[model samples]
Target: MSTDLPTRRAPNWLGAASAGLAVAAIVGEGFAIGIASDGGWGQATVLAWLVIVLTAAAFFGGLVATVVGLGRGAGMAAMVLGLVGNPLVLIWLLGALGTS
Candidate 1:
């Protein structure tokens, strides 16, 4: 007699969530840039906070998905986006602060 074992697949939702959050972070950063260009320090600061929060969420979510073996590619992409975006946001904030 021959027996077959079922293979387990990781949940795709985690990957999807991570990617979505990363995209949101990018959008938030764009808004922050616009606010900064307009010399709206208060608004820009608020938007910067939004960007930071979104990037953090994406990073943690991606890390969890990756460590859990759930959709490595999507998780890796999200993590990369978060890593790159976070530093850029910080630089923008620093420049804004210096100009103000």
Candidate 2:
């Protein structure tokens, strides 16, 4: 008799939800910063969109890795990347892009 345990996998819903939350956090922060920085609604919208793209890219990368059984590292990397990069990029976009 042979006994073996199957490898654990990342839950699709959990992964998807985590990514979604990350994106939302980034966008929400951008919105608040934009409004406070005199960006108005339009500028805030643009900032939010930028964050969305960044998060989407991270999500896609993580998803691919997860499918290949490398989700642990990839998901962690994605979360870290989003948490670190989002604020930095948000500040830059708000200040540099301006609301003109």
Candidate 3:
């Protein structure tokens, strides 16, 4: 008889890729795409860009942690933090733009 041992989480390279793609999307959508549009952009748009940048950074950091053999939970935590930060950034951007 044979039994399988429990496996650790997959390398989760996707998490890193996810982070990179997210960054590209943000830059493409908010800065490049918006600026290239007919109407000019605003402070809110800039703020949205910032959020995406931060999220990208967090995802990279999480990837590093995972590569260093840190627990998957910690890596996931960092990703979650970025996810939480995203909406708040949008809200702040909206309020700031409105007041300006």
Whole-model Cα lDDT of every candidate shown, in order: 0.82, 0.62, 0.60
lDDT digits (tens) for residues 10-48 of candidate 2: 555534554555656666765757685884877776666
Evaluate residue 24 in candidate 2 and report its C-alpha lDDT on the 0 to 100 scale: 67
| lDDT, candidate 3, 15-94, per-residue tens | 55555544554554466445547555675567567667777676667666656745455666666656645645657878
Give residue 6's error in model 2 in angstroms. Answer: 25
Give per-model TM-scores.
Answer: 0.78, 0.38, 0.38
Full candidate order by TM-score, most accurate first: 1, 2, 3
Clashes of each: 0, 0, 0
Best by lDDT: 1
TM-score of 1: 0.78
Pairing residues by index, what is the TM-score of model 3?
0.38
Best by TM-score: 1
Give me the runs in candidate 1 sitting further than 4 Å from their true place: 1-8, 87-100
| lDDT for predicted candidate 1 compared with the true structure | 0.82
RMSD of 1: 4.4
* Candidate 2 residue runs with Cα over 4 Å from true position: 1-28, 31-39, 69-71, 76-100
Candidate 3: regions farther than 4 A off: 1-41, 70-72, 83-100
